[model samples]
Target: MRGRKTDGDDERLPVISIVGLGPMGVRIGHALQAVKTRYTLLGHDVDAARVRAALGAGAVDRGTWSLAEAAAEADLLFLCEPVDAVCATLAQVAPHVRPGTLITDTAPLKAPVLAAAAQWVSEGVAFIGGHPIVRWPTDGDARPDADARTPAVGDGGGSVAAPPAPDAGSAAAVARSPA
Candidate 1:
């Protein structure tokens, strides 16, 4: 009798790319990798060394120089860039984002970010503002549990989900600063 083949044998995982290889960015990439095996965490930065470091550390699977390249393949794009960098990044990558893509950011502040997101909305991209209630030290070697408890999403009469959990060893336990 001939051997039977199964569809599972050739299945491939969807690639999820993360732009910006900063501290938080690396952590976001790793966090997703921790949960799913099919993830392709694409890391990028101005500095080639940072991209190398993230890949070497297993935080990201590979590196891409262009934001548009990564955005095209990402099912969900997580932006871990600084507050000031996000606006320009979005403008540059807006044309490449496919329709119905879910984009999120972890900027420190809220007001300015919300304004920036409005522009993307005009361009047909959905942006959600999330401030991970945590921050890691300059030198920490741990990651948060993939299933750690995170904040609930509130419908701001808008389309963005709540922020995700912070890095494992983040110094500021939550993304919010101590009062």
Candidate 2:
């Protein structure tokens, strides 16, 4: 039967740390929370108040004042600091960070952040750049059924298209994995 064909699937979500608990950081946390399968969220900031605010907002499961504690256990660390603070924060935190983790910073100016990421490269970790084209207010949270699907492109015209429905196995992967 069709029902009997689907049973075994358990994909663990990676531990994610958000370094700056600003608006973007809050939104990222909200989106990951909306996905709601499993993940350990470590959030930190130099401001003790921001740490408390993120925890109070339910944006992070745990909040720490120590950057070292946040970086040690994360599989991916998102630096959400202000444009000017990104490089300085990286300089302080990069040395103690774990290998093989994905490091991303959300500074408005790309050039400086890019240069800093390049300078702090380690053997196992990958430094990538990310900027959210869309912005959200501090009070907002991600919609629970936000429909996070990639749209396909139409060939002849400028119209957008949708991909074919994935199989049950692929559907399970999409449900459990982080974007």
Candidate 3:
């Protein structure tokens, strides 16, 4: 794995690549930025604007379009796209990942991801299926159907926003400022 030095700390920063810079991707990026992990975040997406938005929002350290370029030497990789896209992306990314590279995805279903991952696990690329597992409660659940607002899907492991004071059309804003 490649690493970059941080000022005052001799240890090298691990590289974390985030593929698919959509809402989930940006949310992942936002949540990552909220923490103080000493790792470089590299983001990529088929949509250039989303990548640009992630970069501009301080969610990622850098952005790229090439799957191989983004996967090379990455210590950790997060596939934050839809299920089908995640499967397709895994194939393209698996080849470039070095042994010991930990790869995971935000797909709702584990079967597909695990099935797709089977091809590369033997090669030392570890794949884990990521999911929320539990949802405590949402704005919709708390109130009557007439008043409830549907819960917005998030990056799997995080608190969901409550009712009222919603961010217009962007869930990314909600991600930037977590509950």
Q: Estimate each model's TM-score.
A: 0.68, 0.67, 0.71
Give me the runs in candidate 1 sitting further than 4 Å from their true place. Answer: 1-12, 122-124, 138-179
Measured by TM-score, the strongest candidate is: 3
The CA lDDT of each predicted structure is 0.60, 0.62, 0.67
- In model 2, which runs have C-alpha deviations exceeding 4 angstroms? 1-13, 137-179
Query: In candidate 1, how many Å is residue 40 off?
Result: 1.9
What's the candidate order when arranged by decreasing lDDT?
A: 3, 2, 1
Please say which candidate is ahead in TM-score: 1 or 3: 3
Per-residue lDDT tens digits of candidate 2, residues 87-171?
Answer: 8877777777777787777666767776776676565676666655443323454331122121111111121111112331212
Better TM-score candidate (2, 3)? 3
Which of the predicted structures, 1 or 3, would earn the higher lDDT when compared with the native? Answer: 3
Clashes of each: 9, 0, 0
Give the clashing pairs for model 2: none
Clashing pairs in 3: none
Consecutive 10-residue window with the lowest summed lDDT within model 2: 148-157
Model 2 CA RMSD to the hidden true structure, in angstroms: 11.9
Tens digits of lDDT, candidate 3, 1-179: 37667778777889889898765666667667767367898999887887777787777888998889888847888888898998888888866888878777777776777777765444566666665332324543421111112222332434322211133221321233244
Candidate number of the best lDDT: 3
Per-residue alpha-carbon lDDT of candidate 1 for residues 1-179, written as tens digits (9 for 90 to 100): 11122247754445566677766676666656567554456777777777787787677777878777877766567777888787677777777777656677777776666666666543345566666644344345433222212211111111223422233121322232233
